[model samples]
Target: MVELAGEILNLPIPPHDEVLPYSESCTDKSVHDLNADNVVLCRAGDDNQLGIILEIQREKDKRKRFSWPA
Candidate 1:
């Protein structure tokens, strides 16, 4: 996975000790809840290394521009 991401991003991604499925929800008390299609958590040892969020959009949605950043 890291190899694929590094190739696509053109940036070196360090090796992670573990990769796990994460919650799809992103919620803030001051803002509306945002849900993604999938979320991945990358960990190195006991610390969190990176978080990957995946949102699958089959059709164009103008609202995605605003919601994606949240």
Candidate 2:
């Protein structure tokens, strides 16, 4: 997964020991639920290396621009 992300996004992601699924919910003080489609956690031993959030948008939604940043 790390290699694939680096290749596809041209990211300089470091090597990780494990890849695991994470919580999709974002902590926000809002009434609406701000949840991503999926979240991934890259770990290098006991340290957390990176977090990747995957959101699949089938149609154009301007609201995503604001929500994604949160």
Candidate 3:
């Protein structure tokens, strides 16, 4: 797993999805909730803004679950 520091953004923000590329191991969420922190976890490709990375998935076996927004 790769770690990075950056903000979280949605579509029509940066319009770049090549920064982080894709994961063949498992699916990834475009935007993740930080819950109590108010922050979010997103792929470098999906993020438009730039923030700092607080944490990352240390376990390679942990396949991230992704879903379509409602």
Full candidate order by lDDT, most accurate first: 2, 1, 3
The local distance difference test score of each candidate is 0.79, 0.82, 0.33
Lowest-lDDT window of 10 residues in candidate 2? 25-34
TM-score for each of the candidates: 0.74, 0.76, 0.19
* Candidate 2 per-residue C-alpha lDDT over 1-70 given as tens digits, one digit per residue, 9 for 90 to 100: 5577678889888678899999998667866677888889999999999888877789898987676777
Report the error of model 2 at residue 29, Å: 3.4
Best model number under lDDT: 2
Writing each residue's lDDT as its tens digit, candidate 1 over 1-70 gives 5556668779666678988999998788788888888888888999888787777779888987777876
Give the alpha carbon lDDT tens digit for every residue of 1-70 in model 3.
Answer: 1222322432233333333322222223756433221233334555544322233445654344332211
Error of 1 at 65 (Å): 2.4
Q: Which candidate is the best by TM-score?
A: 2
User: Global CA lDDT of candidate 3, please?
Assistant: 0.33
lDDT of 1: 0.79
* Clash tally for model 1: 0
Please identify model 2 stretches exceeding 4 Å from their true place: none
